[model samples]
Structures are given as structure tokens and as C-alpha cells.
Target: MSSVASQVILHPNVSKSLKVLGTNLGRDKLYRAVQYFARFLAWYLVSRGYKVQGARWNALKSHLALARKLMRLGKPIEHLQAALRAAQIAAEPGEQITTICRQLGYFGYLTYDTLVWANAIKFFNFKPSTAEKVSKNANRLWLAGILFSITHGLLKAGRLANDVRKLQNAHLTEKGQDVDRDAKLGNLYNARDATRHQFIIDLLDVWIPASNLGFTNLNDGVLGIFGLITSLMAFRQQWLAVNGK
Candidate 1:
């Protein structure tokens, strides 16, 4: 089909019309359409960062790790640009991921000053308002990023698992001995992916809420632990991806 035809078919009104015509349109299709329409709103709030009270980091969390590594290694500005491109390509095409890449790209541009100042403040441990200001900002940003990863990643994995379950159920037949093997294989893959996502989600959900409730502030110590473990996992993933393992 032509691009225009595909767009017309995917349009919300068209989808609704199909549903009205007794088409067995899945709820997932409707949900995806709604998400597409809400992309701009989500992107706007996400770009507002901490300003809007509850905006989380989204995929910018991944970029932040690369940012941290780049800044620490004194990598050139070009390296950051390359990393931003990489991140953009890795993420699915959508306003939310676009905002995340842009936000992290802007931060990457500040490497010369922001990274230097941040490092100096950390090393010196200035106990006055300057230190407090730095600490507070860092803590809040880290908390936002960590929570964002946990929540969104879990939701995505859960949705995948649910879809697989639906497919598996739809394949159930009267002939019990001749089961649909493809559905079984798909469920196996879903189970593996779900387990991985749940593991990370569980790991963060435990300490993150606990740290927040106990102190009402997720500072360096709390977020640091979350970031550290997640980063290690990310590194492992990168290694596997690069090696085609």
C-alpha cells in the first residue's frame, strides 16, 4: 500500500469506523492509536523535566549513562553527537523518545562546563548552599531517571507478555494433542523477556520506594546504587548486542 493509504487506514476515525463495522480490532490497536495522539502532550511534559512536578526521565536515562561516561573520559563534542544519533536510532520513533534524545543532547552540549563544575563540587565537598544546591539537583534528576526506567520498561515488557498470552489463547484448539507450537515458542520468548524486565523492575521498586519513604529524598547514595546496578546491566546488553550473542 502507498504511504498515504496506510496513513488513512491507521487514522483514528478510520479505525473507529472499522470497529463499528464489526471488525475484530484489538484493544492494543486502539491503545496504540491513543498513545500516538497523546505523544505531543507527553513530550511537552517530559521536556518540562522536573518543572512539572511529576515528569520522569524516559529514555534519557540511557543517554545519561553514556553522557556520564563521555564526560568522565573527556571525550570530544563529536563523540556526544555520535552517541545522540545512536540513541535516537535505538529508540522507537515517537515524540517521547525524541524529547528524551533532545534533552540528553542538550545536556551533552554542556559537557565542558556542567561536567567540570559537577566534578569540582563533588571532589571538594563544599558544605554551604552551593553544595546543597548541587546535591539537591543531582538527587532529583537521578531519582527521576531511575524511576522512569523502571516504570516504562516494566510496562513495555508487560504489554508484550500480555500480547503473547492473547495469541497463545487464541490458538487453543479442540485437538489437544495437536497444539500450536508457534504460540508455545512465542510464549517461551515472552516469558524470558518478561522475567528480565520484572527482575530489574523488582530490584528498583524495592529500594527506590523504601529510600523515598524513609528519607523523602533520594540523594546520591540511594540513586547511586540504582544507577550502578542498572548501568552494569546496560553494559552487558551492549556487549551482547555488539557481539551478536
Candidate 2:
């Protein structure tokens, strides 16, 4: 029994999962998954006339959201640092501009979101109107950040496509460079795949802030599913990164 127990504990998959859960990003993703699930479940229950159950799920979602906000208290500075780093790195003008803008947008969103969290916890005694305004601004900034991310992804995809075309054209004439050409193509393909994955995540996530800012009439159920999908996608990426897979 001890041998079996040790084997289970030492399993690679189990170890990797434990490593994933050990990180803040991993834990936050897991919580976000559950939170959005609760949101969708609450909406579904209420639509089916299960008022009491729906309320319970709604409470769960709210609590989890507050917890996530607390977890992200220091993230604004991280975005600011990223923006600073991007400014120093040499890249195409468009890439640098979009990256800096995206980071700044996220910095703004997280800064205002901190205020929202403080108000919720009574740490700050803002008026109802002020709180609402803060929340709206946070969502707007989040939406802007997501839009910038999408634009970055599109720009990257276009550049990758052009590189791919050039590589293919070079392959025809560069007979002795087959190995080098293939290696470069492989790297580019991997980058393209990663960019596409992030693009999809950004696309799904945009609707969440858009709905919050009243740009769309999407309901909680729809928004919940979108959040859930993007959370899982991000979670998977984080998991792979942690495991070096």
C-alpha cells in the first residue's frame, strides 16, 4: 500500500499538476474557471425558476471575483514593467507601439479594479455613483487592452505569413540549406500556433468587458461561457509552460 501511495504521489502527471497549482497564475486560472462556471450556472438556474439555488451560485461567483481581484493587487506594476521593457527592446514600430499600448491599458484596468475591490471590502468609502464609474472605467480599460492584444496578434500573424512565404521562396534556390531552412520554418510555425491561440483567447475575452460596459446585450450565461473558455485556454498554456511541455 505504501509503495502504491508513493508511486501515485511521484507520478509525473500528478507532479506537474501540483507544480501548476503552486503558482499564482495557475491558482487564479482555476478559480476563474470555477467562478465563471458558477456565473453560468446561476443564470441557468434562474432562467429555470430555481431562484434560491441561483442566488447561491451568484454569491459564489461574486465572492470568487473579489478574491481574484485581491490576488491581482500587484499586477498593475507588472504591466507597467512590461511596458517599460517593451520600450527598450528593438522591434518593428507597430509591434512596439501595440505592445506598449496593451500593457498600459492593462495597467489602467488593474489600477481602477483595485479601487473597485477596495470599495467592495469597505476599505474605501466611495459613493455609489463613484463606485459605478470606477467599475465602468475598469471595464473600458480592459476592453481596450484586449483590443490592442488582438491587433498585435493580427500584426504578428501577417508578419509570420510573410516570413513563411520568403522562406519557401528561398528553399527553392538554397539547395544546401535544407536543414537550416526546415529549422527556421519549424520555429516560425510554432510561433504562429502560439499567436493564434492567444488571438482566440483575446477574441473570447473581449466580449466580457464589452458586455460589462454595455457595448453588447450579451447575458450572464453567454459571458460566463466566454470567460470560462478563455480561462481554460490560458490555464492550459500556463500548465504547459510550468511543465516545460
Candidate 3:
């Protein structure tokens, strides 16, 4: 498809951001960062005693698009937003009490995933189906890069470097949490070809929820997620040191 056809009408608020980032960063990666930043901001606002508004609205729109595409909900954004807002009001008097509200955990997760994926698609200029697999592929490369560079990067993660593939299929339950009680995402290591350099860049992203029981703040959630990443990196380093991969 032509670039124009694939190009999206990102929010007015985001146009300037793209302009600012133009030509200075890699393709798709820069936008992917923006999408993540957007999610972090939404969580940040909620933590700072503010309600999620525009971000939430656009978030719903993005997720709604996905749902419609996949034949899930098949509805417009306004209908869902109105319903969500009313439900939010009916759920709690304020942020102080939301537990009483009747809401599904999957809804919250879906919203977060949808918004992230939407921004990612818009920013990366890729379809959702394609972007969905990018991380997994990139992570595989990331793990390989670590092994190649160190030859023994697995011991640090408390596993052999060759076993890195396990993480790709592992779940929170399969791999018990560290002392922190925070679980890790599906896979942290990925091997991706950087859109800019064309040289491969190995990287990882470990997603953590804001709440343990569904009431934690975003910052803590991110920290917890990254904390796991830190361990993985550290372990990789240690394995390399010991094994000299």
C-alpha cells in the first residue's frame, strides 16, 4: 500500500510530536516510544489525582477499532465511552472507592492493551496484525544478541543462555515471581531489525500492571515490570562474564 493509504490521522495533539520527532529518530521505533509514553501519561494522570479524559477517549477509540475489525464488539467509540463514563460514576463516588463498581478485569486489561496497540500502530505506521508479532520477533533476536555477545548470558538470568526460548512461551504462573511478588510479561528479549539503522537491535519490554490486586499506581507497576527486566539484563551480563559467550 502507498504511504498515504497507510498513514493515519493521529490525534491533533500528536501531530506536533511527530513533527518534532521527524528525521531525528528511527522509523516506527520513535512512534512506538510515543505510544508507550501515552500509556504512561494516562497512568501518571490518574496517580496525580486527575481523571483520564482525552487519552482515555482516544484509547477507547483505538481499542474499539480493533474490536470492530476483529468482529468482537462491533460498536463505535461514543457508545462505549458513554457507557463507560456512566459505569465509572456508578462504580465509585471517587477514586477513593472503585472496588464496589461492577467492572471486569479483562476490560481494564483490554483498554490498556488496545490503547497501547493503537498508538503503536499509528506511530509505527503498521497494521495491528503485523505490529503484534514485532515484539516477539525482536525479543528473540535480543536474546540471541545477548548470547552471541556474551556466549554465556543465561546463567545471570538463573537459566542457561540456550534456554532463553522458554521465556517466550512462559507465563506468570509457569515462572514463579521473585521476592518482589511482581510477575514478568511473556517475553522480554527480542531480536528486531531497527527501522533506522537496518542493523538488528536486540531489546525487551516487560509489561506489569498498575495494581497487584487492581488498585496500584502506574509508576509502581512500571517499576515492577522494569525491575524484572533489570534482573534479566543483569543475569545476562553475569552469564556472559562466567561463560564468556
Best by TM-score: 2
RMSD of each: 20.6, 1.5, 20.9
- Give the winner by lDDT: 2
Question: What is candidate 3's lDDT per residue for 70-161, written digit by digit as tens?
Answer: 33222234334544674556432332122212122223334444444555557436566765555344333333333332221222233322
Name the TM-score of candidate 1: 0.40
Q: Which window of 10 residues has the lowest lDDT sum in candidate 1?
A: 23-32
- Candidate 3 local accuracy as lDDT? 0.37
Residue 84 in model 1: lDDT: 62
TM-score of 2: 0.95
Tens-place lDDT per residue, model 2, 52-91, is 9999999999999999999999999999999999999999
Instruction: Return the lDDT, model 1, position 106.
Output: 33
* TM-score for each predicted model, relative to the true structure: 0.40, 0.95, 0.24
RMSD in angstroms, candidate 2? Answer: 1.5
lDDT of each: 0.47, 0.95, 0.37
Question: What's model 3's TM-score?
Answer: 0.24
